[model samples]
Target: MTTDENLGKAAIFDLDGTLLDSMGVWDQIDAAFLAKRGITVPDDYMETVTAMQFREIARYTIDRFDLDDTEDGLMAEWDRMAHDAYTSIVQPKAHALDYLRYLKATGARLAVATTMPAGLRAPALGHAGMLDLFDAIVGVDDVGRGKEHPDIYLEAAARVGVPAHAATVFEDLLAGVQSAAGAGMHVWGVYDESSAQSWPAIQSIAQGVLDDFAQAPRPLA
Candidate 1:
């Protein structure tokens, strides 16, 4: 058992760039999807769409490309490609699995609140051998509202049977941090070299920031 497991507190993780390095998977998926439709978007399209729900991205793609297909069709194609890329190339973020294991061993209740669909979240976590680490795995559809809204975080906290205020959220995006903060959870900002330079808002909201899971210095409150 690890110290974290004994905390009697819940910690929620955001999956994409936060718990796993799957943002690039989404980028590749989006590129492929747009390419198939003979459409192209800005170079930083992925950055622009970070933390967006599928429905939201679909609307963006439709508006940007003026596609022939219905929104459902476009979403299907994108989701299929994303699932493929996630299975083949996406990887857990550095130290993410180990940190989850430590949290489990130490008796903390761990959960995932992500924009990813439940179908994808399961296999990805299973592949990383971290699926069982979570007491709850909530996806975008499980909540009343999406990212940038507190509903998902609130739902995750509820899933763990904890009040939102007692949970700690680990996230990489500003919007997600804001959502969790609004849900009244303590927040931890996880950073990469790329995001580190532009995380002022997250820095302001986070109780603390860490480069990776190995650097999670504080015990759960």
Candidate 2:
């Protein structure tokens, strides 16, 4: 699509698995967090909490495994464990930065709808050189819900000053795709190794699907 075609359209992106190759960090954290309490991560645990808000994940974990940690305590522990990694080690997905820049330069409004913690959002995206690329960034906390619902995506569109129909959401997980599409936005599935199990379903639902940003659909019909 030409720059003219992109005018007035908004692009909403998810951070962790979609634009950033950071799901491994969370997986490692989950394993470590469980190990600290003398257990291993259950096979279904990751899928269950993948799209939940940080606080929701904490509460669910505490209840599922009977962990003796309060929601605040667990969240604090996760923040401590994740802060340095995000600022120092996390990286973006292949060609994600270039694609975002191209879209922005072509006049597409860009926003982020992510499950990333509020405190870590800026530092993490900044570390990946993505902090300046977005017109708006809204996290689960901002919408008071996770990707399992359409609230976060809707908030991002609202902040971008675009109607849902004028926006397209790029997501790696099935839940994110489902939620964003439910909000009446166009949806494109971005493939991530972390979400490989759900790729087929995502492909069925997303209007377009690509494993790399370089292959992301242009014009975004």
Return the TM-score for each candidate structure.
0.90, 0.96
lDDT of each: 0.78, 0.90
Candidate 1 on 1-221: residue-level lDDT in tens? 44543466888998887888877676667667777777775776765666667677777777877777787888777667777667767788888888887777777788898988666888888776788889998877776456778888888888888887778899888888887887678999988543554598789989988867888744675
Badly placed stretches (over 4 Å) of model 2 are 1-3
Clashing pairs in 2: none
Tell me the deviation in Å of residue 90 in model 2: 1.3
Minimum summed lDDT over a 10-residue window in model 1 is located at 1-10
**What does candidate 2's lDDT look like per residue over 78-173, in tens digits?**
998898899999999999998988888788999999988888999999999999989999988887888999999999989988899999999998
lDDT for residue 26 in candidate 2, whole number 0-100: 91
Return the clash pairs for model 1, or none.
2-105, 2-106, 5-106, 5-107, 5-108, 6-106
Best by lDDT: 2
